[model samples]
Target: MSDTNAIGLHQGSASDLAAKLNELLANYQIFYMNVRGYHWNVKGPNFFELHEKFEEFYTDLLVKVDEVAERILTLGHKPVHAYSDYTTLSRIQEDKDVHDGEACVRGVLSGFQTLIEFQREILSVASDADDEGTASQISDYIREQEKTVWMLGAYLG
Candidate 1:
């Protein structure tokens, strides 16, 4: 068995958790910026409605980015804060010049898929590490995002 860290999480597991959290942070940063781009650039007859929706999504993403960075700190790792760092580590990339309503919604759905996958990975590792705080936080995200995926899917149809 691995030794536990000072924070009561397993040392090797905590280190791995921190690394994964950093990856999650990177993805969130990219996703947040992407949504912000969507908010700013979305156009069509649906502009008014989609603009507000994108704003709501990006704002929520910003909060999650902060939470993920803080969680990394709690695990005894510094979060990578630079955009360049995010670009390098993130699976999600910054979307640019995407003004179409349908495209923006598709991008959001794709980003959410990536997010759910990352959170699920984090959940599994957190559970193994016995890190209830991390597990609970990601679990909440997965549930909320799943509902969002459904609602957004309905919007797309």
Candidate 2:
């Protein structure tokens, strides 16, 4: 007989969901580090505000990273914890020494967009598998990230 997890999800289904969750987690990890770099290195007249904003964004991303990892574990899979795994799995590229405030904001927007798109994909997979927990988490992330993109766009304009 085939095995199913505690949530009645088949091992294959759980494996797929866990893989996607790991990818999402990887992206968040890189994005968080990028934002931290932005916070630490942002320059120009808008320094104070942009620094504070980047810190806020990174802090939020950090929380979501942990949540995604936990979600993967809940699905009976190990979360990828190494930086090398993040670099390989994440579509978001590593950013370094991005001092210009506008450039940093642009990077943030781009990362947010990538994450939003990625999570939407995960949302569909989780929904199909009846993983309401993963689906709901991704949905909440999408809603919040959409609002963040709007806000960031406004700031850019």
Give the clash total for candidate 1: 0
Best by TM-score: 2
What is the C-alpha lDDT profile of model 2 across 79-107, one tens digit per residue? 99999999999999999878999999999
Residues 21-116, candidate 1, lDDT per residue (tens digit)?
Answer: 999999999999999999999999899999999999999999999999999888878899898989999999888899999999999999999999
Q: For each candidate, what TM-score against the reference?
A: 0.96, 0.97
- What's the lDDT for all of these models? 0.92, 0.94
Worst 10 residues of 2 by lDDT: 1-10
Where does the lowest 10-residue lDDT sum fall in candidate 1?
1-10
Judge candidate 2 against the unseen true structure and give its global Cα lDDT, from 0 to 1: 0.94
Extract clashing residue pairs from model 2. none
